[model samples]
Target: MLAYLADVFSALSELNHSLQGRELNIVTASEKLAAFKEKLVLWIKRVKRGNLVNFPCLEETVTENSTLPPTFVAKIVEHMQMLCTSFDGYFSCGELQTCNIWILNPFMQNLEDVDDDGSIKEDLIDMRHNCGIQMEFTNSQLDHFLASQREAYPALATKGLEVLVPFATTYLCEQGFSCLLHIKTKSRNRLNSEHDMRVALSTKTLRFDAIMEKKQQ
Candidate 1:
């Protein structure tokens, strides 16, 4: 039973790890969540049919024992059903159509399909033809690319920013806690960690070579 659950949780753990990290946004989170739910549905069907390919450890144990008890197999199916119900209740597709299309590729989106006034559509048309900015959009991060467009394409960029900014706050809180642990040691028990904590939590990249060149030996 424990081995069977380990297989189930191993799949979930991989999904959880993929959704975490500093750079994660709703776009990536939504895609992963949708894929995981689909896998759960497929697993439920496979397990019901006695297909243990998805659960290697469970299969190995059953092979050694000649067969798994009927009661425990039923329990596993029930557990998977409960998980699918819980996930469906918690997550829903809430991002707007324009936001999704813009993130994928602004140039490719049809102006008619965009859910906006004429102004945003006009901005999109202009952006599609601007080869210079198009190159930058392809090269840069979604949030950064949208940010750079704010001056030239306020409406379009603002909509994208609304979707791209505000990534997982839970991730930020956990990151801050990890940084605190690294900075606060037994030897430095008396030290004030406010300044060091800021540096550790900051998203800015530090240039060690430039700092060393400026420092007096």
Candidate 2:
């Protein structure tokens, strides 16, 4: 399912890049959108089957892309919204209605105890909002879902349940550096050689592991 999501995201990135400088057409965008939706449905089905639970609902809201034609972007957004709404209580968050099966909501309710300054609460709200807009599940929800799924499909769900947060955090940090390099180098250049990039990434990974170990202690 993770691989499927990655593939869909890659496709979306490709489509976004392809649409740049080209006049956006509904037909062309719709074709890409349809493929994306199909992949999403397949992903959901796989997740549902692996977990032995009913699929969670998904909702997508694309803010207007002014660079593209309004009609074209609107059509794509509408299609995404429909595809997202087709699921059950899987991914809904914030103003988009809560999922009854969400185990993370309880944890989130207790955030006040952990976050006396309220920054964590604010960050969670933002994360939930983004999840709604992107038609993707929250990390909390995903964690709980995978954990529960592990009970039903031990082999399939164990790795995800164990590593979801660490994996996601690592991915985000890597992507952040990737984005920084892209903008600084204009995506047409590389500041470091392949060996240097690997060394830097390895250093970051070791640092993260050490920090996590300290936290656990």
Candidate 3:
């Protein structure tokens, strides 16, 4: 079961890499992940029925009980789906086709113990009102707006920035560590490549425009 999950995640590494460091709305990722899990269950059934089980007990477990619940899939999905969002509110944070507002409502409601400066509270109200009316809440717009008002709303701006902070998906981190291990293999260590060691390792592809420019040069 663990090995099957590894296969599923390996297939998803490219998607995880593509999304790293980008402001995300995980509604679609969650749907695709659920679909993939269903596909995996079907594959498992096919393999087991065909005598492809790696262990004898796996054959007994899968072949005997054709109607057995996919306990492994359920366990994995329980934790993974927790990290996903079902768009509980009216905002996409600039990640949707139809731009909507209310992205900051839930996050604001969650903040506690804020210092009571009348100015900061006023700024928060104004920012929320103004941004909520906009067609979208893009990361660049958020950055510029916050930068211009940092001194005016230090605490609010900090918290607002935190709300927009991006996180790497689990598969991306696993693939990165895998790459690091491969790059620093004992055979390569013998070559004393300090310059190479200084480069940050990543699995993401470069932007298409940047790659084209490099090729021209």
| Ranking, lDDT, top scorer first | 1, 3, 2
Clashing pairs in 1: none
When summed lDDT is taken over every stretch of 10 residues in candidate 2, the lowest stretch is 52-61
Better of 1 and 2 by lDDT: 1
Per-candidate Cα lDDT values, in order, are 0.81, 0.43, 0.48
lDDT per residue for candidate 1 within 111-176, as digits (tens), equals 677766547777887888899988998898888898998999887888888887876437788888
TM-scores for all predictions: 0.87, 0.21, 0.35
Ranking by TM-score: 1, 3, 2
Please give the RMSD of candidate 2 to the true structure. 19.4
Best by TM-score: 1
RMSD of each: 2.5, 19.4, 11.5
RMSD of 3: 11.5
Query: Which of the two candidates, 1 or 3, achieves a greater TM-score against the reference?
Result: 1
Off by over 4 Å in 1: 64-67, 93-95, 98-100, 116-118, 186-190, 202-217
Kindly list the per-residue Cα lDDT of model 2 for residues 64-135, writing each as its tens digit.
342334464354445445656652233222221132212234224444343334233444445455544224
Question: Per-residue alpha-carbon lDDT of model 3 for 121-200, expressed as tens digits?
Answer: 55555665675433334434554555555686676566555545444245446656666676778877676444443344
TM-score, candidate number 1: 0.87
- lDDT for residue 206 in candidate 3, whole number 0-100: 45
CA displacement after TM-score superposition, residue 153 of candidate 3 (Å): 2.4
